[model samples]
Target: MGKVTTGASMSIDGYIAGPEESGFDLLFQWYGNGDVELPTGHPDMTFKTTKASAEYWRSLIENTGALVVGRHLYDFTKAWGGRHPMDVTTVVLTHNPPADRPLADENFVFVTDGIEAAVAKAKEIAGDKNVGLNGGQIARQALDAGLVDEIGVDLVPVLLGAGTPFFPSLGVKPVQLEGPISLIEGKAVTHLTYRVKK
Candidate 1:
């Protein structure tokens, strides 16, 4: 059994994306700032990051077997040009599966039922590896549903004044979280992880 994690890169102001999705260049600077080359499923999207970030990114990719993302992100990336950057299976949690998609494949799976089902299917696919949840909407719903075991963040230095938050408003406050379990400092970014208190 693997853990379910909410992993994202957020600004100092705690936003995953800036207002109108304007500050991506600032938030994703670390992905291109270092000498280490990290390849992705996309032939054109390799990451150049510092040794620390490179190590962290590698570990992330190694442990993450699948992802649960919302429909918004699925459509936003145009289905990541047919596969996600991590090169792992991605489970999309949506209201409706895309009309043209096969709904199940080596690269993608569409779960239209709900977040719980999405997580379960992701976990099944993940096997012994971790399941990563993407986007604020998906993360929030999983957090509220107690499906998230860990929270991972690559904290960037910039502050996106206003934008989509990493975690949207929940039904309750101060949901207890245990130790930051791990923290690694990378160039222009700080990788942090906290375990959710059961």
Candidate 2:
């Protein structure tokens, strides 16, 4: 019994990343860069300050046990050179398996086919900690299959006019909010936890 968390920095318009994103440069631009803080005036909500954003990100990352991501993300991690905090047990979801992956360590394992297989493998490996659904597509798969129990979404303060949509196409389902926690430092970072009504 573990929670499935989906964490992403979305625009005010609800886009997760910019268009044609083979890799997560958009993710790096928003989460990686700490220089320019996301502006606070969002039509949907405001991120009170930058410190709040950092605190929120840290909190989410700290809770994640294992990661389930697409092959694209795995390749992106490889291109960015070796070793990342996400270098723990990762199950890459893809149709075609890679001939050779840079991460050959015992921690990294590739899962071809679908999210259920990936999730089952991750849970088997991750004993006690929670599982993190790495991307929008993967999240959709988990949500559709009723694998995810909870989600942690970080509402950043910028709107990328066009980018990856946070919530992709999926069948209707009920999700009830547990409670909202706010980390107020520079800005206000809110973690809205949701329980998927199964």
Candidate 3:
């Protein structure tokens, strides 16, 4: 069986996005500041990262077969211009799906149920690969339900004084994790992974 995981690019002070959706320039500098070229499904989207980060990204792409994202994130990027850059099937946990894409297509799946249902749908699509949960809310819900298997954090140097935090409040506080099972240093980012200790 595949694992369920979530990850984010966070600042030193633990913000995934800055206030008013700002600070992206500082948060994502590593994405374009490196020599290694990593291409995405979007023609215009490509990542230039250090060799280590490139390897990490490649591994993520290989292991992640599907994703579960919240509606807020879906709307934020305008559904990533009709498709997610990862080129994988995405399940959106939304109260109401968008009008244009009313049905499930190659690009997206809409789940009106709760987070568990959304994760289940993504798992069904993922098969032997991992199901990546996107956004802080989704992760917190899954963590509260004890569904997540691992957590990955790409730690950057800068701190956003106020903004969306990477790890949101979990009802289950003091959750235990085992091992920084994997760690790598990239250009201005340190990638860390921890297994959720149930």
Candidate 4:
């Protein structure tokens, strides 16, 4: 089996999205200057980044074998137009598994059962590689279930006063993390990686 991990770009206040679930447009401002283009086909899409930063993002995408995401995120990105940015096997956790699966690419799978089932399916698909949790809520679910192996945060410097928090109350015992594997200080963000204590 492979390790389950998660990574998110958050604000100083720990919000991944702004008020009214406004999207991470501001939080991910680092990628807006032609360094990275999300959703693949934006009108102003471009890819230009420093070697280190490119490698950082690439490592996450290349290393991940499968991804688990929440339904809200799935819909937010329009299911990434049926093709996720990472191009890996994606399991979407939702009660409503679209009426027609064929609308999406073969790489996407909707798991209606629950978060555990989604993670299980992702792990099954991932094999020896890592299964990445791609949304805050799903990440919390995996962490609460003791299935997460690592939690990575690209801590941005901004402060969104009121927004969707990245780590909501799990209502469980405190979870410990150790060793920030790397702390890459960028002009707009600081990447922090920690291994989840078992």
Count clashing residue pairs per candidate.
Answer: 0, 7, 0, 0
**Which is superior by lDDT, 2 or 3?**
3
Write candidate 2's Cα lDDT for 55-79 as tens digits: 6555555666677888777686572
**TM-score ranking of the models:** 1, 3, 4, 2
Compose the digit string of candidate 3's lDDT tens values, residues 8-114: 98988988999999988887888888899999977789999989999999999999999999999999888888778888999999998888886598899999989
TM-score of 1: 0.97
lDDT of 1 at 110: 91
Error of 4 at 134 (Å): 2.0
lDDT ranking from best candidate downward: 1, 3, 4, 2
Cα RMSD to native, each candidate? 0.9, 7.1, 0.9, 2.7
Per residue, candidate 4 scores C-alpha lDDT tens digits across 1-198 of 678999888999888888888747777766654444333333334455444556677777667888999889988878776567677878889988778674235578888888898899888888888999964788878888888898889888888888877767775668888989778765577788899898
Reference-based lDDT, residue 93, model 1: 86
Q: After superposition, how far is residue 5 of candidate 2 from its true place, in Å?
A: 1.3
In candidate 2, position 11 carries an lDDT of: 58
Minimum summed lDDT over a 10-residue window in model 2 is located at 40-49
Tens-digit lDDT track of model 1 for 1-198: 999999888998999999997888988899999999999988878999999999999999999989999989989889999889999999988888888989899989999889999999999999999999985889899988989999998899997889999889986567888878999999999999999988
TM-score of each: 0.97, 0.74, 0.97, 0.89
The Cα error of candidate 1 at residue 96, in Å, is 1.8
Q: How far is candidate 2 from the true structure (C-alpha RMSD, Å)?
A: 7.1
**Residue 83, model 4: Cα distance from true site in angstroms:** 0.5
The superposed Cα distance between candidate 1 and the true structure at residue 11, in angstroms, equals: 0.9
